[model samples]
Target: MLGAQQPASDQDRRQYQRVKVMLHGRLMLSDRTEHRCQVVDMSPGSAFFATDATAKTGERVIAYIDHIGRLEGTVARVRDDGFALELNTTPRKKAKLAAQLTWLANKHELDLPEDRRHERILPRNPSGILSLEDGRQYRCRIIDLSVSGAAVEINVRPALGTQVTLGNMRGQVVRHFEDGIAIEFAVIQRRETLQQYLS
Candidate 1:
């Protein structure tokens, strides 16, 4: 019995590791129409999003999940509320996804920061353009960077919940300060995504 255990295959891991989550983001159909969706459950191999929009089984989908970045797959099964996604990924990508899920699941259990899994750091290039959905743009200096949000020093203060884009990242104004505003990103962003613009 002691010698029977071995490293599990990806398929085996996928079957056992489905995680329940409430990640908000958007999904695009094969025709390129985007719809707002919420990921209710996920695993490296598959995920399910709760949304009114539905697609036929086998239809290709591209979803941008909050905190998880872009995922491409085909519709596996349709439920009344939503559909399951069968992730198309390489071994490396699957491993990366598994790690992210583990972190999200364990962060709270480990008594880590509840607001964000990662710590905020000063950006390499602090200057950035803050743009509103209404076509207004303002100059801003990045105060700090975290995967979930950023604090920027700007001249204008947008009301809480005002949607804005910092450089290329979409976020919402969550708080106001005398010097600037706090922006929570629409999705949990990869450090690379932050550096692409911040650097």
Candidate 2:
């Protein structure tokens, strides 16, 4: 996370465990253009991202990182605010980029981003259809999890704080953004459900 003051131009741009970079241009992935995203932070292995677009976990995209440059990433998790990107193995290129990333992270002594600052653990984002009670199945991605809450990203925008069900877990929407919902678990205990589903 960046402190209040901007780094002086003459000063080296610090690399954080997560680094925020203003997106420079529109990027295309899967016939869709993902616009207006800020890099939350990055390492050579992976970078966290915040975007206001409809995206699914495990989806891969070509992302352009400032200084470090553009590379492909796999969606790891989704949240109301945004989703996280994980690096995939590509032998030669991955090794080279990873070395570069480690250098930046060490040189900057970067702090963790807000999303990762807490001790909370979230579910690994899944790519699949969730069948609802009424026989309607929705395409959604697991966002995050806590003992009392969880979040999901769906194409439909439900009202703020609305109660919704995902699988056997039920929770209330704590926050709503352009393309996601932050739900507070109300029915299934967070630990139990995560274990069963993830296992």
Candidate 3:
């Protein structure tokens, strides 16, 4: 829990702490392209999916969840037949998905149901880092993530509306908090920004 802390509020607590389901769905990378997929697992922060074709690491993909809704993200890693998605956008979805997950978690409470939880350990599995346009970089720990935005923790706080980049994803500093910063995801790069970083 080096960079981890309590959720900013009760609402954040309920939303971030819940375990979510990964229902089967389709992923349409291009508007005209679609592929069959099974959402093997999900969390407030990320998802693991299985598809016939493996997407290259850092490639951006657009996904549609059955009841949880849709998202846009980049491939964290690729396997022979599937891949792991480290969400570049997914905060609002977390709240919506959390409500759905709460119901499911409660349902499983009584029954001897199977656990469907997924956890992401960072640094070793680091999702992304935060950088100011001015050239300062802060190690960012994601609070909750979605295809639209993410709540991140930053040591040096910026003012509201201050634009910054996480990995290669860009957003504005929407709000400040006691232990971190909240970044609203803005322009999600269609291609994996990691390539630019490596090259």
Candidate 4:
């Protein structure tokens, strides 16, 4: 998708494929105040989010999204329920956002569960970041890793089914232990992302 000042034509806008996505996140306005939001739809250069928080059109915003990291943008349209964010990120970040949108579009197209036995292996590098959907972050250790899920050693126990990001893989709390919690990846990750992010 092309990224610049603005789409030159309707065809250019059409070329910027819009994907229906539902990612939980939070955004900070120019005042640096945060509000809970869910990204409802996204394109290469913009995103729409559902939030009770009101923002004026043309206001600058910075958002921390699940799975997809941080995005900087400005409010393009304000709706009764939410607002559209016109992204001002670099071209590379926009390209990354496009790829993430593609993945979200095909999210239900699951691959056959890899490692049917769900073997857990100790990661060579145990350091990882645990992030909640609301954007709270904590340092965590990868106690064990597998293609489908992970046992992370962190201080807090998010309620079961709470969506979270472990390393760069999106998952949810499946179980909780005394010292940490168990996470099941939202999608069975490809070997490349699994290794590249975790190992």
Number of the predicted model whose lDDT against the real structure is largest: 1
lDDT string for model 1 (148-195, tens) is: 788999999887657789988887776677899888787768888877
- Which regions of candidate 4 fall more than 4 Å away from where they truly are? 1-12, 111-199
Go through the candidates in order and give the clash count of each: 1, 4, 6, 0
Itemize residue pairs with steric clashes in candidate 3.
89-146, 89-147, 90-145, 90-146, 90-147, 91-146
- lDDT values for all models: 0.79, 0.54, 0.60, 0.76
lDDT of 3 by residue, 1-199 (tens): 4443222333543456535343555797644478867666665555678889657777777787644567667777788778877665445555666676676456446431122231211222334588987898888777654444556766788876566788767766655778887665553334334344323
Which candidate, 2 or 4, would have the higher TM-score against the true structure?
Answer: 4
Model 3 residue runs over 4 Å out of place are 1-22, 30-32, 108-199
Can you list the residue pairs that collide in candidate 4?
none
Which stretches of model 2 miss by more than 4 angstroms? 1-26, 110-199
Query: Candidate 1 — which residues are off by over 4 angstroms?
Result: 1-16, 108-184, 187-199
Model 1 steric clash pairs: 67-188
Listed per candidate, the RMSD to the true structure in angstroms reads 7.4, 16.6, 17.9, 7.7
- Cα miss at 54, model 1 (Å)? 1.7
Question: On residues 54-114, what C-alpha lDDT tens digit does candidate 2 reach at each position?
Answer: 5688787776653345667667778987776666434455556656656545433542211
Ranking by lDDT: 1, 4, 3, 2
**True lDDT of residue 79, candidate 4:** 94
Candidates in order, TM-scores: namely 0.57, 0.39, 0.42, 0.57
